[model samples]
Target: MDFLTLDYFIKLFNIILIDLVLAGDNAIVIALAARNLPKEHQKKAIIWGTVGAVIIRIAATLAVVWLLQLPFLLLIGGVLLVWIAYKLLVDEKEHNIEAKPQLWPAIRTIIIADAVMGFDNVIAVAGAAHGSFDLVIIGLIVSVPIMVWGSTLFIRLVEKFPVIITIGAGVLAYTAGSMLTGDPFVKGWFDENPVMKWAFIAIVVIGVILAGYLKKLSKNFISINEQGQLTIPDSIKNEAQIEANDSFEAKVDDQGRIVLVKVAKSEG
Candidate 1:
């Protein structure tokens, strides 16, 4: 395995950008949630929360790396990642999670929020990593501090230079293309037709950018009750075919982009 190739560096760089853009949001949420705690507890909450979140991220990325090895899953994951990249540009949902009053509560909030809000982050990183556990580990390790302490600096940087996001999304699109190339069913065909292979990747990268610009950003903001219980619109529930006891997986990032996906009945 020659690791000095330009392709390797591109993937590594993609992982770095993905981590930089996606990691900071989690950090901001932790800081805001921990701010309500006492000084000593705040310190502990930040420390433990960072550790717990990083650990879970590591596990999740590893799981994705393994899953991508399955036949045709790489192709599916790549398509999903393309949508995720597009959503990274336009999907902004807010999670009105309450900051806890106590130390454990605050820490728990940070961890839970990280886990919930981290769905895209995890999948994006895994896609960029391209089954390289080294890249995955490096990405997570490099991102931990950013997610824990560098939220404001990154937030400011992104605000000042919004193009940075486009660059990151492009990198994600490249990885998505790579996934399709690596798909077991298509690998041989692409290997025989290198020109067509590059063409497909270039198309995926260009298509994501065009779609991202042409589509409007969707707004899905749901408010929580005093107890942090969310009230879904009856219309939404009906459209989604949600049952009275349906469960959801909810996450909120620093930018306050909240996502709520209904879980399967068995999983619920």
Candidate 2:
């Protein structure tokens, strides 16, 4: 495809989407790993970990792209893509956000987890690129930090609008289907019957949506406890509490009476 052509743009767009979706989990892992450190250490850990993650991700993606050029490797990649897409759509929610690690430990954990989990990212990007190096690199450069910094926001948005997750999952499944069709083992089949290739793509996309919808329905019936100190059930209520705290103060009257009261911080 010509670099400036519509096909190129579409390919780049899909790469960006894959990067955005897969990258968020890695970013969250980094943030959570660093969250328990001393404030200063936490900042350092995030910065250094992000830098390390970027370098590792870039290297891994390049390696995967190179390997993908081999005959039949695309079939492996395509199967991996489908697995990743399914996991993204149906994986259980991560309830254990890791405590902040010590400086060296946090960095180590971040690097190790990212190195292992990052293959999903690399394969997804490679599939999206359809073997275009420039497009893959550009997509990574643009989407990585957005995925990192904006992950918390993305998580909140997913909670607020659950359909976004379903749509994102469907996109990944579509990308997976495309990857499968492009595989050397499948290429001839796809070429001979383009309708079959399109049918597979439709099945993947629809299957993801149906699965997500059913999961969403089941989740609705599984009632989460609405009362918890750590759980913020409503953003408005949470913001109101924060504002109240920002303006709060203890006041003393002439008789030494305490006029304003708030929950006292506990010494853990």
Best by TM-score: 1
Name the lDDT of candidate 2.
0.74
Please give the range of 10 consecutive residues that has the lowest summed lDDT in model 1.
214-223
How much is the lDDT of residue 101 in candidate 2? 52
Error of 1 at 131 (Å): 1.8
What is the TM-score (0 to 1) of candidate 1?
0.77
Whole-model Cα lDDT per candidate?
Answer: 0.80, 0.74
User: Can you give the TM-score per candidate against the true fold?
Assistant: 0.77, 0.73
Off by over 4 Å in 2: 95-101, 215-268
Per-residue CA lDDT of model 2 for 1-268, tens digit only, reads 5878898888788777777666666677887788789888987887787788778888888878888878788878877777787777667545354564589888877777677777788888877777777887788888877787888887788779867666667778887788778877778889899998899889977876777667545543423365722322333335445444433356898999865444555569
Model 1 agreement with the true structure over 1-268: per-residue lDDT tens digits: 3588897777777787888776667766887888888887888998998898889889998999889888999999888888887876765445566778899888888888888888877778887787789888876787677656877888788889988878878888888898889889899999999999999999998999888866542223345799998776554666778788878897997789987777876643
